[model samples]
Target: DAGITQSPRHKVTETGTPVTLRCHQTENHRYMYWYRQDPGHGLRLIHYSYGVKDTDKGEVSDGYSVSRSKTEDFLLTLESATSSQTSVYFCAISRDRGTGELFFGEGSRLTVL
Candidate 1:
């Protein structure tokens, strides 16, 4: 994509540790989202931000947190890493909030052992 970046493309950590993933976008869109993909569950939204310093939790946000201090940057953090939290995380940007069209970044894979 022209305007998206995900840091730590791959990461491995032990259980009970903490991990953070960063997403950067250059598209200047008002919507940025973080999602996790697993085998059966497919993709599930973790959090999203409509603008700077404005964010809301998603369906599976129990152990995760997100922050967007700037329009081009969004961060996702796992307070305490766990095996079940292992999955591929993706950051998406879209101009239209209700539309399905979005630009996604290269996924970040995390493993917890």
Candidate 2:
């Protein structure tokens, strides 16, 4: 985690509650991404940011929202968490999307009961 930081590494919350996970990076990479890992689904992209204030939704964007106010910080918010949302979230940084090299944070484990 040289350039990345994730807060609330572990969380337990009830269904329908709101949850937010924060990812901070010092590498100043141009692209930051949010991904969730589940047993059957493997790793799925939730959202991504290309630059400050420039973000986009990913394949699994439903039920998830993301914001990036600065180059080093990205936020992921689950408006209303659900049991299906229980998964380990990872933050990855990359200079370019096609580079095939992504620096990932340890992870943020969130369990929605």
Candidate 3:
């Protein structure tokens, strides 16, 4: 919150590992998101970017992979990590997406074994 910043808050790899999660924002909000919080599929949407580089793909985008050239940066990759894709990953930012209002980043928990 308050400018978002999510790094490797916690992680434990295995099962063809290759995880990378980093979302840093200095309030350059143009819209950037990557969410995943399992346990009943509470929060889906695994990709988003509406500015730097422009991107799309959500609703649990298969495998997951995203990047923003700049504007604060947003990256989430799991090139080859699986195990039901363990859970907990959030990085959100929104200046205005129809007033949806989103500004989160204090989560990054991955465990695939």
> What would the TM-scores of all predictions be?
0.96, 0.96, 0.32
What digit string (tens of lDDT, one per residue) describes model 1 on residues 1-113? 46799999999999999999999998899999999999988889999888899899899999999999888999999999999998999999999787778889999999999
- The window of 10 residues in a row where model 3 has the poorest summed lDDT is 1-10
Q: In angstroms, give how far residue 113 of model 1 lies from its true place.
A: 0.7
Best by lDDT: 2
Tell me how many residue pairs clash in candidate 1: 0
Name the runs in model 2 displaced over 4 angstroms: none
Flag the better candidate by lDDT, 2 or 3: 2
Candidates ranked, most accurate by lDDT first? 2, 1, 3
Model 1 scores a TM of 0.96
Off by over 4 Å in 1: none
- In angstroms, the error of model 1 at 11 is 0.2
Give residue 91's error in model 1 in angstroms. Answer: 0.7
Clashing pairs in 2: none
lDDT of 3 by residue, 1-113 (tens): 37788998899999887899999999888999999898876888888999998989988789888889998998999899989989999999999799888988988999999
Error of 1 at 8 (Å): 0.6
